[model samples]
Target: MAASSSRSFAEVQRRVSGVHRGTDPEQQLRFYDGWAPEYEQDVTILHYQAPRLAASCLASAIQGPLADALVLDVACGTGLVAQELQAKGFCRFHGLDGSQGMLESARRKGLYQELKQCVLGQEALPASSGFYDAVLIVGALSEGQVPTSVVPELLRVAKPGGFLCLTTRSNRSNLRYKSQMQQLLDDLEQRGLWEKVKVQEVERWERATSEQEAMEGSDYISGVVYLYRKAQTVGF
Candidate 1:
């Protein structure tokens, strides 16, 4: 694993654990609620354009109108991608997240058919196994309050032969953190749970506005998108 000046994996792990320690969902909700108004602004200032690119990538990869498919959007922060999906005619959209503020923002968009408030790692999904035809997770694999255990849970809820699409920062940027994501993919493949369908690196570029001259610097970030298809059957 390559070294990163960014937060250490252990440090991120500790933070995630601490966020859930209080056992009060409202505490988590308040944190995201505080972040909602500025969330998009902060990400844009930071050049976090992966979500839009990931949404486009997923929109192109899906076989048909997502309207016909039951879809789940995990950790759907501000419903950016969910809004995109809905715009593309996907009607049965279900969004799940731990932050009440995020869900509030999502609800305001009127994109989701159903919204559930629960932590991704701890909350059990309301659906049965193999219930959804597609699952889209964009920009949720990074540190900062994301649960590492949610990966397997995603696969567990997806139906056989369903599609699971994920996007995250590239391995080149942070190998240790990227390795954690790779491990999730590898484990799913090894268990005959999913088959690799597409993998690509996406680059996003942003230019500073006149008002934000001081923020002009390196204007691009590298990210990766991985799309996998769950197998029709798994052998024990």
Candidate 2:
């Protein structure tokens, strides 16, 4: 799909809705693989802000030299999060995504030291324990996307005291999923797996895509960015 300044909301909504209709991980991967080329453009059309917001949340929580931080970007998706982190002075990045096409698109940017394909929830993250200074997964934790169970893998990959940043939509459509995910995060924190650093709720996460939201006169969807630091020692 070619870039079009004149692309309407209907087109963007249609594409987004198509991906949502995917019944299984394979179907979702196929949809994303085919959309990879146009993914950035479509998100740009939606004014997607989770990548930037999550990156910023992680960057602020990082303690040492930004350039030395080995960041693992989960569901990297065309390197949008890496791009935002790079703008903040972080250098090394390792990206992972389920779609080969999406990984290829990220590779073209030459921002990552490594890139791999791993379908979230289905496979273990191909990263060593306690290896990353920071790990982030943006735009992947929402309803019908990655499940909250994957949070453990994210925690496993981060160094003790390293940050883990995640984002999810807080709009009406995602409210139940968000609540469940939030419970998991809170439980982890209670168990000393990690501690909360910041949690920000933004009213304008992206342009509203559903007709129900439009009917409700909402122009943008809400989202939350969650930042947490891995515990240095187990409390359990």
Q: Number of clashes in every candidate structure? A: 1, 0
Number of the top-ranking candidate, with lDDT as the measure: 2
Q: In model 1, which regions exceed 4 Å deviation?
A: 1-29, 171-174, 205-217
Tens digit per residue, CA lDDT, model 1, 1-236? 01123444344333333332333445666766777765655554455565566566666777876678888998888888776666666678899887777888788888788888766666776667878888878776654445557777777778888888887664233445668878979987987789998887765522222222222243444568888888898431
Q: Which of the numbered candidates is closest to the native, going by highest TM-score?
A: 2
Off by over 4 Å in 2: 1-6, 214-217
lDDT of 1 at 64: 70
**Per-residue lDDT tens digits of candidate 2, residues 1-236?**
12344667788898998755526888888888998888887888898889888878887888778999999999998899999999999999999999998999999999999999999999999998999989999998877778788999999999988899999988777788899999999999998899999999998888988866442567888889999999998432
Counting only residues 3 or more apart in sequence or on different chains, how many pairs clash (N, Cα, C under 3 Å) in candidate 1?
A: 1
- Model 1 — TM-score against the truth? 0.76
TM-score of each: 0.76, 0.94
Which 10 consecutive positions of candidate 2 have the poorest summed lDDT?
Answer: 1-10
Q: In model 2, state the lDDT of residue 164.
A: 92
Model 2 residue 192 lDDT score:
81
